[model samples]
Structures are given as C-alpha cells and as structure tokens.
Target: MDISTDVWGQLALEASQVYLTEGGQVRSPFASTTIEKLPDKVLLNIFSYLTHREICRMATVCRRWRMVAYDTKLWTHVSLRPEISGLHVSSLESLLALISIRFGPSLRYIELPIELITHTVLHELAAKCPNLTHMLLDFSTAMQLHDFSEMQAFPTKLRYLCICLSEVIFMEGFMRKIYNFINGLEILHLIGTYEKVEEEEEEIYEVINVHKLKSATPNLRVINLYGINFVDDSHIDAFSSNCIQLECLAVNFCNKVTGSTMKTLFQRSRRLTCLLMNGCSLRSDYVMQVEWEKSSVQELDLTATDLSTECLIDMLTRIPNLRFLSAGQINGFNDSVLKAWVEAGTARNLVALDVDSSDNLSDEALHRFLSRHGSQLHGLVLGGMPHITDQLWQSVLQLLNNANDGRYYEIVKANFERADRTTVVRTSTNCRVSNYYLLSNYNDLIFN
Candidate 1:
C-alpha cells in the first residue's frame, strides 16, 4: 500500500492546485496587495524619497497617486535656485505662480535667487506662506538693487535668513532694511564676494553697522560673515556682548578682523561652540597676550591664518571638547605644534583634523599622530604636503584600515599632481574612489 515517489509528488501538486484556484480560475496570493490599495500615508512616505521632478511625474500615474504626490508636506522645503531646482524659472510671474499654486502655506524653507526677489514676490510670500521660517537669497549675480525697502515686506516669522551678496555700494541701506524687518532672526549668514586687492589699497564700500544689527536681532544664535572686509573688532564686540546665546560664529576671509575680537567673543559668548576664522590676519600680538579660558568651543578653523604655534597650542589646551581642527596653510603648524597638543591630551576628542599645506610637518610627526588618533577620525585632510613621503602615507593608510573593522572608508577626494609635488587626500565614508595615479617621485597609491 506504499505510494511511489512520482505518485506522491503528483498527488501533492493536485492538492496545491485545489487551494490556489477558485471557480476554475487561478488566483495569485498577492492579487489584493496592489500598489493602488496602499494607504495614502504610506504612499506619501514613498513619495518623500523622490525628487521634485520625479514626484511630479508620479502625479500622472493615477488619481490617488496624483493626490499623494501633490501633498503639501512634500513641498515644504523648496529651492528656486536654478542650479539646485534644475528647473530654469525665467520670470518672476512664473515663480509667483509656482508659489501660489504649488507651495503656498506649506512652504517652511525656501532658497530664492536674487533676481526673483522683488517687492511683489516678498509681499506674496508674506501673505501666502504663513509657515515660512527660513529663507536664503543669493545676490551673487551682477544685478544690483539701489533700494532694499521691499525687504520690509519679508515674513515676520522667519528665524533663519541668509543673504549672499556681491561687492555692492548700497550695503548700509540694504542691511538697515533687513535689520528693521527681521528682528526675531535667530540665525543670520551674511556672505560677501571676495575680491583680490593690492596690499596697500582697500575696497571701501558702505560698511554694515553690526552694532545696530545686534540691538535689532537680540535672539541671534548663529552668525556667519564670510569675505566681509568691513567687519572689524567693533562689529564682533557688538555681537559677542549682545548675542549671549550665540553658538556658532564664522568670519572667514574677513581680513579686517584680528585676535582682539576673538578674545572678546570667547569671554562674552559662553555658549559658542564653533569658531571659524580662516584667512584672517590673526598674527597680532593680541593673539598671544590673551588669557586662554576653559571654553566650550568645539570646532576651530585657523586655516590660512598667521597664528603662532605657541598661541595655537595654548588655545587648544583650553578647548577640552575640541572635535574638529583645521590648521592648514599656517606657517607655524610644525611637528612641535602637533606634539605639544597630543602630549597635553588636547587631541583626545578630535574626530576631524585638517593639516593641509602645513609645509613644516614632518613624516615622523604625522605618522605618530595618526597611529595614536587616526582610528577615531571620521575626516582627515592631508593635502598639499610636500614633506610627507609615499612610504609614510602607506603606513598611515594601513593604520586606518586595520582600525576601521573591514568597513570601507571612502576617499572623498584625492588629487595628485607631479608638477606641484603634492598629494591631496580627503577621506569620509559611503563613496567609492574613482581615479588613481602614479607620480614619478611617488609610488602607485590608491586611497580606499
């Protein structure tokens, strides 16, 4: 009475067929699990991962998808910049139409090009977008406006505002208009274009009186003034004294600023964590004279500055929580500086280190530093170092590889040139290295 293997298989197939079919028609188990049957919330979550153009295309699929694609939540943060949006919106009328139709009350943050920012546009944004809180206007173009009275129509609810302006003569009036309007601003970034001038000459434009701004925006938390040559000690003193809640301040490429202001900021701004003073003339005696305090500053960028090694080492001793340090292109950043910081236990919390163009750093000093601290670093920039040989570079890489636990650390950017006799290495995670080159003086190297 025992059944054969073929006979048992046939019987089992017939039994499965009986359950897989009803009314003599075969049916799939997933027939009821179609995409159209998905909940609107799930569909919106899926659409959130799509680009603006892709979301628009998905709208043409079905009625339900159209509704989900056009959800106001999906259009909260919109970038009208041509380079970012990938849509060349030519006219103000078209931009206005898009705002009124697509991104009305749902708009929370927007980046608008300077050309699109007009009186009517500002008025429309204020009237239509009640939830708008962050706005960035790029004025890096050639278009100049003599009057910025239209800024008075800006949304009062804005907390973060960034204005990228080129070298314009009407900075005073423009800034006055902005300060008068956005009194409740918390984060303000005023970026200006950097122009090369002769050493003895100066580019004199109407200076922005930041002292007035500090009074106007009392709730300021973060201020980044890049390439603004007019910002001096008085301006920074105003912000340091008034903006007590300031957390981050960047005055990169502002040559007019010196170490006097740095002392003021450190003493006054107790909550400051990030201080970026790249390309500023911090070579003054005031930098060495200040009494270093145990401050909360975490990220310090002294790139292309003129800080003496003693000053830098003394400063590092005070910053116990210092995580990111950029000391590139500084003449005094030699092995002694590295050794001093490491010995003083200042490099314990350093997660990112940049020593690019520090011509004085030796291979031995770099190798020792990396051997001790390279494993925990998420970012390391060692570009423009002619002193570091290929052998030492390989040892540094080996140390990092052994410590990374088989996880791939991406070489975000690695540029090598035999002409300059320099190697640039920038490392992070989640990207693949593309190109590799061998110089005549250096061995074949591939960063992973």
Candidate 2:
C-alpha cells in the first residue's frame, strides 16, 4: 500500500509540534523516528532550497535541523544587498553580527551595499573571512566615501571585484586605494551611472587611469568598464599591449572609444573572444580599414554605432568564429546586410543575432536569413521594425518551431509601465531568446 499521501498530514502536524516545543522535543514517537532517519547530509541538502530567512526560521525546528540549516556550504555565497536578500538597511549591524558568528571563514562570495562598507567593517571582514575571494559593492545610492586610505584593510585574497558607482567624486582615489590590496584580481567590472543632462553639452565623468590599473593588476583576464566616459583608444591600447591573457573586454557607452581602439584590440589581443563597444562613435572608414591576422573575437556588440553597410559586411568577414552579433540601431543595416551575411556563409555559425531598431530591414530579408540559419539561432531580437508586423512575427515563430524538430516555442511578453516602457519576449527553452521593444527614446537595450 502507498503510504505517501496517507501519512503526510500527520507527519506535517508532528513536525509543527516539534518546532513549537521549547527544546524541540517530539510529542509523537513516530515523529522522532521519522526525523532521526534523515541524515545530516540529506537535511542540509533539503535546507539548500530555502532562503536565508527561511533557513534561520528552520533552525528553530529542532537541534538536528539547526545543525543542518547552519551548514557552511549554504552560507558560502551571501548577498547583503537589500533588494536581493529582502534585508532592510537598518538591519546591517545585526546581519554583520550574524555573518561573524555563522559565516566566518566559509564566506567565499558576498554582495554588500556601499553604506555598510566602513573602515571597521573592512578590517573585520579581512580578519574574519580569510577565504573570501569575490565581492560586489553596490554604490548606486551615490554614497560618499570619507577616506580612501581605509580600503587598505580590504581582503587581499579577492580575485573578482565588481563595483557599481553612481557619479562618485572620489572614483579614481577609491580605485587606487583598493589596487594595493587586490593585486591577484582576475576580473574587474566597474559600472557607472550616467545621468542625462538636458543641455547639449556632455557631462564630464571622473576618469580612472587605465595605465595605472594595468600596472597594478598584471594578470587581469576580464575587464568591463560600462558608462565610464574616460575610456578612450589609449586605454584599449594599454590593455592590448600589457594584458596578454585578456579574454573579454567591454567598454559599452564610453562614447570616447572609437573604432581605432577596436582595430588595435582585434590585431593585438589574440585570446579576446567577447568585445562590446555599444554606443561608441565607430566611423565607417576606421572599421573598413581594420586588418587582423586572425581575430579570436566570437561575440561582438556594435549597437548604436555609425558603421555603414559596407563596413559592417567587411567586419563580419574578419571574425570567422562569430557566434553572437548585436548591431541594433544602425540605419545602414538593411536587407542587403542580411543577404551579404548569408551569401558569405557568415550566418552559419551565428547562434544569436540582435538587429533591433534597424528600420531598413524587411520581412523578406529576415525570413530568408531565418529560414537558413533558424536551426542554429537560439536567440533573435527584432524590435522596433515597422516592417515586421504581427503576422510576420507569427510566421517567424512557426518557422523557428518547425526548424527545431517540431519543438513548441512559446512567446512570453512582459510589459513595463514607465516613462521608458519596454516589452520583452523570451522563448521557453534551454536557451533564452529575448526581444526587447522599447517604447521610448532609448535605442539600445541594456543586457545584463
């Protein structure tokens, strides 16, 4: 007889009784027997599915549960970010106390708000969390740092550091202070918030010297400087010359970066695979003149650039192993570009393509390209195309569905109601295909 359903209610009641009891004393003999049968490993595995708050609540269930719930593995990666952990800003002290008592040396990764990263806190983290290697500090609140010298106490073992700053005045000084501590850092991502000014003049951003960074972190492999206005061709040239093992470099929205830097990277950085330069001033002449012995670049994003049709086609021919290509908001991107890609066999290796806001493309060109490369493509974004009607979308969906061995593909659209409204559609598959339609002035979709 199957007793699974029959005993569930009774077991649940017994479990509740065990939790409510002062010392977690089991009221029923059956409950004690059942609870004892589950080993510590199994209990820990079960607790892994729960949130940090839920895990803390589970500790009240019984002594065995308390032991399992507080397992070091479950607390290795901790997020103190209020948005993610559902933690309040005022509860930071209590959270720090909990981390000191529970996480201790086991915390390998942590995400903290800038407000909580004080001099004392840094020293405490450095002393207590000896094994901590990855840290992400969110400064989106535009918190001001009193002293950069305090960062000398930051954990030295950190290999991955991501900081999100919002027009902070001491950006350069803050980076320099931490540079002394994180010499072994492999990945550094600096994300800056850019506020648009109504005037015609551009807002000047605080520049961090890339040459100094290159000297400090010699073994750097991945660097992403998003919306940092100071990045230019000199910075890219510095990385290309020094950081030989660099794999991925993204300087998206740094309008100062022109195609000259891209040309430098393509020719010098052989191991580079992903290069994102969206919202830069990439001139047609500079791009057309790019010559490389053999570019290892596979993923490239040139969204909102000034590249003409001929230059784009020529650039595509250079990167033979290209898999992901995003050329959104290019006026010169038309049916001829798609036709050229298909003709040159460049569309064969493409797994994802984003041609959003390219007004000149028609249904015929898209349908033709998809018909040939639909099987290989797992992601396709075609937003803001007036030519692609609802009927065309349905036909494309049908074509994609039929191409993938009769597998059903559904479109999930999420509409955000704001000044800049966005509608995103994704497919329900192992691979996600996102098509973001912006009903606002912003032309480029920010991909996280």
Model number with the top TM-score: 2
TM-score of predicted structure 2: 0.78
The superposed Cα distance between candidate 1 and the true structure at residue 207, in angstroms, equals 6.0
Compared with the true structure, what per-residue lDDT tens digits does model 1 show for residues 316-394?
Answer: 7666778788888998888888888888887898777788777898889988899888887766777666566767755
Q: What is the C-alpha lDDT of each candidate?
A: 0.73, 0.72
Kindly give the number of clashing pairs for every candidate: 0, 0
The runs of at least 3 residues in candidate 1 whose Cα sits more than 4 Å from the true structure, single-residue gaps closed, are 1-42, 57-66, 146-152, 169-181, 195-202, 389-448
Q: Candidate 2, residues 321-404: lDDT per residue as tens digits?
A: 787888889988888888888888866677778887778988788888887887677667766564565555556765564223
In model 2, what lDDT does residue 259 have?
Answer: 70
Q: Per-candidate TM vs. native? A: 0.76, 0.78
Candidate 2 wrongly placed segments (more than 4 Å):
1-38, 60-65, 86-96, 148-152, 195-203, 389-448
Question: Number of clashing pairs, model 2?
Answer: 0
Candidate 2: the clashing residue pairs are: none
